[model samples]
Each structure stands twice: as C-alpha cells, then as structure tokens.
Target: MDAFTTAWAGLTGWIFETLVQPAFYALGLMDWAEDAYDWLDFGLYGLLTIAIVYLVCRPLEAWRPVEPVADRRAIRTDMVYTFLARLGVLPLLAFVLLASLQTRWEGWLTEEGLLPPTLEEIFPPLRAAPLLAFLVYVVVLDFGEYWRHRAQHGLRWWWALHAIHHAQRQMTFWTDDRNHILDDVLAALWFGGIALLIGVPPGQFPFILLVLRLAESMSHANVRLSYGRLGERLVVSPRFHRLHHGELSAGAAGKNYAVLLPVWDWIFGTADWNRDAYPRTGAPGTEEAMATGGWVRQQWAGFRRVALALAGRG
Candidate 1:
C-alpha cells in the first residue's frame, strides 16, 4: 500500500506539473495553482474511476445482463453524460462560480466572528485519527445524500429535474451520472453546503468522491448480481438500487434511498428486501422522449417540466 501510494502521488504530481500547471502558468493564473492542482487530481481520479467501472462492470453486464442491448443509443447518451461528468467539465464551471461566492460567504462570516465549525473541532478525538475521522465524514455525507435523494423524489419540482436519471430503461454503470444539469447543480449545492458546514477537508474530498461514485456506478450496473443478504444490508448492491429505479419506484413512491450504505434506507423504512427481483427500469407515465431522447432534448424536457410544475400546469 505504501509503495502504491508513493507511485500514485508521483504520477499525479507529474501529470499536474507537466500538463495542468503549465497551462495555468501560461494563462497568468498561477494565483489559482493550488486549487487547479486539486481540480486536476479530481479529473484524473474521475477518469480512472470511469476506466475501473468499465473494466469491472462491462464484463459482468456481458456475462449476466438482465436485459439485452435493445437501446444502444440510450446507453450511448449515458456515455456522453459519463464523459461530461467524469471529465470534470461541469464541475470546473461550478468550481469557478462557487469559489468566489464561497470566499465572500466565509469572509462575511469571519467578519461577524462566526467561523464555520469542523467535525474535528466538534469532536477533537477525530483529529488524532484522520482515517477514522474521514470515515465519519463519509457516513455523515452519505446520510446527507440519502435525504437529498428522498427530496429529489419527494418534491414535485425536484422530481421533474431528477426524472432524467430514472428515465433510462437501459440502465448501465454510465446511468449514474446521467442526471439533468440542473439536478446536478442542485445536488452539488446540497452536498457542497453540507461539506462546508462540517468543514470536510479539501484533501479528503477526492477520495470520498471516488468511493461514493464507484459504489453508485456499480449499483446502477446492468449485471445480475447481489452482495448476499447481509452484505446487501452493509453496502448497496445492484439489486438494491435497481429497485429504486424500477417502474413502480418512480416519483414519491420511491424506495431504497441510500447511495453507499443501505442502513439509511433501512432506518427510514425505504428499503425493499425483495433481493430476487430486478424489475424493468424507467419512470412510469413519463414521456418516451425522456426515456430515449438525446442529451439536449432530455435536459430541455426536464427544465420545461420543472417550469410547468412550478407554474401549476404540469
């Protein structure tokens, strides 16, 4: 593990210096070097996650696919989403927009003598065991995600935005990131706010993202697999999450709201233990265009739906 860590650091540093740093330097943005470096690492890790998910899930799908590839085009659209997200295109924009606002917010808070509280400050023992502290943060963040997911399903306007993700009947690993851009923004704000509140260390963010995203992708995979009854309770399995995306689970009627841990769903009475079932995916009563439309069409549809819903005409 030590050797692997050293090698990974060396490679990440080399790539950032050779490619990312030089571009920033040339553009007179060296003042933002530190943040850019982190973004670079985020992109690299995201790409690597995509590769790893593909390596692991693709074979499983081929071997024991629940359904055949009847809609290659739909899967291809999801691939576009994976690239847009895992490549950090949208995140880069969000970072730029959020960074200034965050700076101002923190500055104003500092002026008012009310600095944000960190988990470490609240629980000093966590500072001594960084790993345990990180795990604690992970649990807290996952808890936030579980509720955010419930809100996505519970709130009518939010459901209009999130319906894009559930509209994919041909679910695959790529489907995990196939959300409406507005939905993604809302999600980003939701979690980003929680992270700031708890003062999640910037250093620990990428690793947390990688772990959560990998589990999420795996949960969406088309593979006919489970982690056994007990194991399924510990971590979300494909069967566990597929039920959340199943036809009957659409809108406020959803279940299995956990992302990484099933405990949330279990606690909230949202978990369905019918592990043997893998029902057909996609939102019932949604337009067919939402299920198989191109990226632009789907995003536009989500926005339009939200607008109509908000206007009391949906």
Candidate 2:
C-alpha cells in the first residue's frame, strides 16, 4: 500500500481500537482487547476492498464517451442557488447532532440501542463479521434510498421538496446540493428516521452517508463515467440519474428518480434508458412560473401552491 493508504489504515485502526472498542465494552458486549483485533482487521481489509473497487471501476468509467455541454453562467447561477439552499440544512444538522449527544450522554443507550448497530455490535461471533456487516448495510441503505427517491417523484407533496432540486437549469457536482431547506430537512428526516427506526448502527451511519454523498457527487460530476451494463446493474451511473432530470412535457414529467440503485425504477416501470430519444433536460415550468414577486414571493407562491393542493384548491 502507498503512504496515504497506509496512513488511512492506521487511522482507521486507531479509531476502532480507541472509540469503537470502548463503546462495545461499555455496553458489556465484548472484551476491550478484541477492539484492537477488530481495528486491524477492518483497517487492512476495508482498505484492500475499496482499493480493488477503485482500480477495477475507475478505468471502465474513463473509457465511456460523454457529450459535453457548455453553460457556465447558468451553472454558476445554479451553484449560488444550491449554496443558499444548503444553508437551510444547518438547523437540521444541529438537531441530529444534539440528539446524538443526548443519546451518548445518557449512557443507558448501548451500541445496540442506536438504530442499526455497527457491524461490531451486530456480529460478535467472528472478527470479520463487522466488516461483512458494514458492506451489507451499505447495500441495504442504498436499496432503501432508491425507494425514497421514487416516492419523491410519485407523491405530489414530496415532489414539492424535490422540485427545488430540479429547479436548476444546469447540472454539475454542486448542483446536487442545490435544494430548498425544507427539502433537505424532509430528506434527512425520511432517511435518517427510517434508518434509526430500523436500528441501523450509528457508527455505520457515517459510512452510509459517505457512500451516498460520493455517489451523488460522482453522478453529478461533469466528467463522464459510464460503466455500461455491469455498472448499471451494480450502482447508479451519471447517465441513469441524468434521465431523472430530463425536461419533458407535462405528460412525461416525473419519470426516473432512483438514486444509488436503478432497480427500483426498473421495478416500478419508471426506468428511462432511451438516451437517444430523451428531451433536452431543464427545469419544468416556465421562467415566469418560477418568477414570483421575488425570492420571498417565489417561496410564498410555492408554499401557497402546496397549501392550496392540500385544501383541494388546485
């Protein structure tokens, strides 16, 4: 392994030994010394697995031909909007952080108490069980996320929050974060709440979030990274996700919405792989439809639209 990989492994090992092990011991689950063994196994094994994935997948992504689109000014505008919208996530983040701190401070909450106990908590039989569990949880959460994405398209109220994401006329990595604060809040609540209720471990939560963010960033990246059939089945590709943002007429608006997995869309009959026949991708509704009195006015208009629908006004 290279210096960076070695350092990462070492750090991961240390974290498992110091933090994870102690937590397990406090829960009266395992001996403290086992933590060291767990750390070393996870650090080395995890590093090797990720390294192999990158080595094999990176080249395939590079070989795909991607069409280039230039619209810097529009992209920049979208970035600004996204940045502004992300500011809304701060309060929600704070709420989650506070809840975490409270759970930790209480001391009554064991590792298992947290939704989705970490691999270590779930499988104490084998040293490698935690590592295996970690991988399983990643896939499971991705599956869950795919359904959540589909719901956002199928439900009208959910679409209100998701529409903020599609508001951008341009696409880029940062464009992925461009969403209304309410939308971000609802998304966090939906995914995190469901994961917690299902007992997903807190330790594993970070890994899940990291994987999702990496997928989101990669899918929105300007560079092309198509993995053809194999990639399509395994993970969501940029092309598959781009179809979700396709600008179609009213009749064909909410088509593809799966995030990390395409299976959900395919299963639900929402998959759209007709790249050659896809309409030009853009935000739905006209510029005038988006333009209200101002930002506040537009926001109010959106709120009113939702309220009216709830009251059966629309």
Candidate 3:
C-alpha cells in the first residue's frame, strides 16, 4: 500500500508539472495552482471510476439485460452525461463555486473557536482502525444520500429537475450520471456539506466516491441481477433500483432511495424487496424532450419545469 501510494503521488506530480504547471504559468493563474492540482487528482480518479464501472457493468448488461437496446440515441445521450460527470466537468464546477464559501465558513468557525471535530475525534477508537472508520464514513455518507434522494422526490421544485433522471426509458450503467446540471450542483453541495461537517479526510473522499459510484452504476445497469433475499437487504442491486426508476414510482411515489446501501431503505420503509421484479423505467408525465431530447434540450426542459413548478403552474 505504501509503495502504491508513493507511485500514485509520483504520477500525479509528474502530470501536473509536465502539463498543468506550464499551462498555469502561461495563463498568469498561479494563484489558482493549488486548487487546480487538487482537481487534477479528482479528474484522474474520475477516469478510473468510469473505466472500472464500464468494464464491470457492461458485461453484466450484455449477459442478462432486462430490456434490449431499442433506443441507441437515448443511450448516447446518457453516455454524454456520464462523460461530462466522470471527466470532471461537473466536479470542477462545483469545486470552483464552493471553494470560497467553504473557506469563509471554515474561517468563521475558526474565529469563533468552534471548528468542528471529526468523527475520529468524537470516537477515538476509530483512530486505531482505519478500515473500520472508512466503513463508518461510507455508512454516514450513504445515509445522507438516502435523505437527499427522498427530498429530491418529495419536494416539487427539486422533483422538476430530478425528473430528467427518471425520464430515461433506456436506462443503462451510463444512466447513473444522467442528472440535470442544477440537480448535480445541489447534490454536490448537500453531500459536500455533510462531508465537511463530519471531517472526512481528503485522501479518503475519492475512494468513498469510487465505492459509491461503482455501486450506483451497477444498480442502474440494464442487467437483471439481484443479490438473493438475504444479500439484497445488505447491498442494493439492479433489481432494487430499477424499481425505483419504474414508471409508476416517480416523484412522491418512489421507493428504494438508498444510494449504496439498502439498510437505509429497509429501516425507513422505502425498500421493495421483490427479487423477481424489474419494471420498465421512465417518468410517466415528463416532457418528451426530457426523455428523448439532446443534452442541452433536456437541460433546458428541466430548467423550464423548475420555473413552472416554482410559479405553481406545473
């Protein structure tokens, strides 16, 4: 592990100095170098996530697809969303926009002598067991995600943006990232805020993302696979999440809101444990543009829906 960490750091340093540093120098933006370097690591991790998700889920999809590939165009649109997200377009935007707010918030807390304690600080035994602590962080973050997902469905205006995600009739592994840009930003804020409050380590954050991303992509896979009865309750499966995307499960009628773990759904009464069901996906009343339009068109339609919903005309 130490060797791998050293090699990884070497690679990141080499790439930054070889490419990013020169670009910063030429653009007279050395002030932003530190943040850009951090984002470069995120970008590289995003690439690894995309590769691992595709290599694992794509084969399962081909082997046991619940639905055939009837809408290539729709799948292509989802691929665009995946690339935009996994290539760091969305993360970079969130980082740039949130960095100032985070700095100010941290500064204020420091001035007040109220800087928060990490989970490790609260539970000192966690310091002696890194792997266990990582699991705890995963559980906490997944719990936050479950509630955030419920809000996306329960709140009308948020649902307006979130409907784009449910509008995909041809959901695939790529469909995991098929969210409205505004919804993505809001999600980043919600998730990042919780991470900040709990003091997740910067090194562990990307791995947490990787673990969740792989699970989410697999959950959205077209493949019809489920962890058997006992296993299904432990980890979410494609069978479980596909039902969440079922046509009739849109908006306030949804279930299975857990992102990585199914325990939250089971505990909160949102789980559907039918291992035999793999219902057709898509939101019933969503605009056609949201369901089948190009990326920009879908974004526009989602934005318009939010506008109308906020105006009480949706």
Judged by TM-score, which candidate is best? 3
Q: What is the TM-score of each candidate against the true structure?
A: 0.94, 0.62, 0.95
Segments of candidate 1 deviating more than 4 angstroms: 1-7, 204-209
How well does candidate 3 score on lDDT at residue 43?
82
Candidate 2, 1-314: lDDT as tens digits: 37866786687678777877777778886754563454445444444444443454345444652434465655555545544433333433635554575466444545546343444555565346655666666667767777777666666766654565665445656566555555566666666655554445435433455466567656654445555766775677777666666676221356656677777777878777654432345556633333222344445555665565567653
Off by over 4 Å in 3: 1-10, 205-209
Span of 10 residues, lowest total lDDT, candidate 1: 202-211
For model 2, the local distance difference test gives: 0.56
Candidate 1, residue 25: the lDDT equals 95
Model 1, residue 46: what's the lDDT?
81
Write down the lDDT of every candidate, Cα atoms only: 0.88, 0.56, 0.91
Q: Cα miss at 213, model 3 (Å)?
A: 1.9
Q: Which scores higher on TM-score, 1 or 2?
A: 1
Ranking by lDDT: 3, 1, 2
User: Per-residue lDDT of 1-314 in model 1, one digit per residue for the tens?
Assistant: 67967887898899989988999999999999998888877887888889888888899899998888898999999999999988889878777777776788789999999997899999999989888888898899999999999999999989998888999999998899999998888887888888778877766655666667778899999988889979999999999999999999999999999999999999989999898999999998778878999999998899899999899877
The collision pairs in model 1 are none
**Any idea what lDDT model 1 has?**
0.88
Candidate 1 lDDT for residue 239:
93
